[model samples]
Target: MTQIVQSLAEISKPYDALFCDLWGCLHNGVAPFPEAVAALQAFRASGGKVVLLTNAPRPAKFVIESLERMGCPKDAYDLVVSSGDAAQDAMFAGAVGRKVWHLGPSKDDGFFTEIPAEWQGQADIERVDFDDAEGIVCTGPFDEINEVPEDYRAKFLLAKMRDLPMLCANPDVVVDMGDKRIYCAGALAVLYEDMGGEAMYFGKPHPPIYDMARRKLAAIGGVEDGRILAIGDGINTDVPGAAGEGIDCLFVTGGLAHDQFGADQKNPDPELVRAWLGARQTDPRYTIGTLR
Candidate 1:
């Protein structure tokens, strides 16, 4: 059984660092949650380091910019590690070949242009037409607000026939953008796999992102795995990622699964939370209605 808590400070003493998710845990894609920001700031003030472990399909630099734009104070987190950076490493390493079809919006152009300084001078990655491509690199649906995964079934079937592997950048199936819910790259990837197309992931609940998170943490000041707590609203991505890495998890229930937990965002029904977890077969060490 998972312990239900009201705030992060209740369990902060035992942890040295936090692998915090950004989407529903911190901001809702439109603005910052004041309480979540303050909680992270307080944790850092108490000598805890915070790594913004995100599944955003853009590079860490772009993620930082997004945070800055959203007024997420810089003092809250020490580092930002994104699935884009990890996926870029694999894409550059020839995971999905050089010439691939790009399946995301214009915002994700940074994915192709923002090559790190170290990876400069590598073989060029080309974005070609779906019919002419060797593989697919999906950040998300071109229009997340209006498009569904089924919209691309025709293309995915063709890709399956050609046997072109897809490298998924963001593994989040859906995220709440303000009050509206939108599908992400993972939704499309799930659809692809359901249709017998190969879809590769480098985001949360996957080893690659965790490995990258560990490396990034080590570069600054490494925390023992036991002393690091994973914080997120994503049960599938955040909870399983922490469990697989043998670390504790703090599940923020007021995110995507908020409705199922209860009507109140701050006050969650414990029984409902447990039942939700049971349905998902996930067990987090702690649960909070929201980050604060």
Candidate 2:
């Protein structure tokens, strides 16, 4: 029985910090949600630390740059941790072989070039053609808005035949890019795994990113496990990740699962939310219509 609260202020007192998801919770890829921004700023003003955890498939700096472009101020959160940063460490450590094929858009080229200084000298990664590559590194579709997971079946089959392991940076299947939902690297990873090709992940609901978040959290101020609360709209990522870490979760019903609760953005029917969450085998500590 998840408590459907009206706002974050009601239950935020017990928590010292937040492990917050970004995509659907903070911004819609086009712009920052004003209410969501206020909620985060309020949380920080109350002396709570906010770590913006995301599966954006790119390093944290790129995420911050995009936020700046969207006019989302830097004071809204304490830090940003990304799946791409974790995956980059693994890649340099040989999670996938050195000779890998890059499968993503031109905008994501920074993933290979803008790595952290620590991994710079140790990394000898090379992006080669699919046929000559030792493994595959997938950030996302070459054209996210125009492509679907099924569009890459032929290439996935070839990778399966060659037994090339895929390193998936993002684990989100689909996200609302303003008005349209677009497939992400996780969708491709799921299809690849269904085709018997191995796909490794480092994002939410996965242990690696959580470990990274905790380590980063320690740097600012180590919030005890019992005093930390996770907040997000991603039931798949936020709920499961918080549960796995043994922390409370606040599910924003208006994000990815907004369709399940109907059109009233500010008033989500609790029963519908319960039924849907029960179906997913998740029991988040709290639920709200939106972040504010």
Candidate 3:
């Protein structure tokens, strides 16, 4: 019974707030999607409060700068809420006495800008001093473009050997970068968990990030969750995360799981799309090939 719409303009008026995902919905990492940007502008012009909610492991400031670099104008949305922003409050308190090793690209060093954790080590692809560390904090792969999950085998093995717990900042296993898909921190975290290491996720599909987004929405005078709409490309993260917060979700089919359904921003195969959604056990209230 999901309504597959051609554009968000078809249903923008009913919602007071739009909790939009950043990666797949806005841009494919390389540049901003003009249609997606236009859609957001149109929605905001109609009196809708737009919040760019993302699972990016980097802090809000970093996300903002990156978006600006990628041609995302400031007027496209009102605010940016990131997983790193939500995870900052929990880092220091949770690290109580443990020496933590940060496992991610140098781009995510902003995470330590405020967290009061005893720094054990910060390595990209090299294995950290697991013997001295009690836990691992992963933001993403050292090289997102050319790296795969298998590259982290040695690192995960070391963590597993020491029984170190991992805190994953982003829960997306893979993110679309233009026409290519790249592995993310969540993929490394999942690998460690599969290797018998305890992994804690701090991004979408988890409650804390959504809690932060909802708070932002409320501050903008959009208190009723029913009046808000969440839009994203990931069924695993966006749909489930919004539904858990009692908000309606509009799934974007072209960005992440497009290959599975042979879909694109301009064209979508309905039967294949339906089968994929059914297999995933997610029922988004609306579906679109793109945000437009």
Model 1, global lDDT: 0.94
TM-score, one value per model? 0.98, 0.98, 0.91
lDDT of each residue in 16-68, candidate 1, tens digit only: 99999999999999999999999999999999999999999999999999999
lDDT of 3 at 188: 91
TM-score for candidate 2, please give it: 0.98
Compare the candidates by lDDT and give the number of the best one: 1
lDDT agreement with native, every candidate: 0.94, 0.91, 0.82
Give the residue spans of candidate 1 off by over 4 A.
none
> Rank order by TM-score, top first?
1, 2, 3
Clashing pairs in 3: 7-292
Residues 1-292 of candidate 2 have per-residue lDDT tens digits of 9999998899999999988888788988999999889988999999999999999999999989989999999999999999998888888888889999999988777789887888867858999999999999999999999999999999999999999999999999999999999999999999999999999999998989989988999998898999989988887787898899898999998888888887797789878999998998888999999888
RMSD, each candidate, Å?
0.8, 0.9, 4.0
What ordering of candidates by lDDT runs from best to worst?
1, 2, 3
* Residue-wise C-alpha lDDT for candidate 3, range 186-254, written one tens digit per residue: 899888888888888768989988888877777877557878899999888999988888889999988
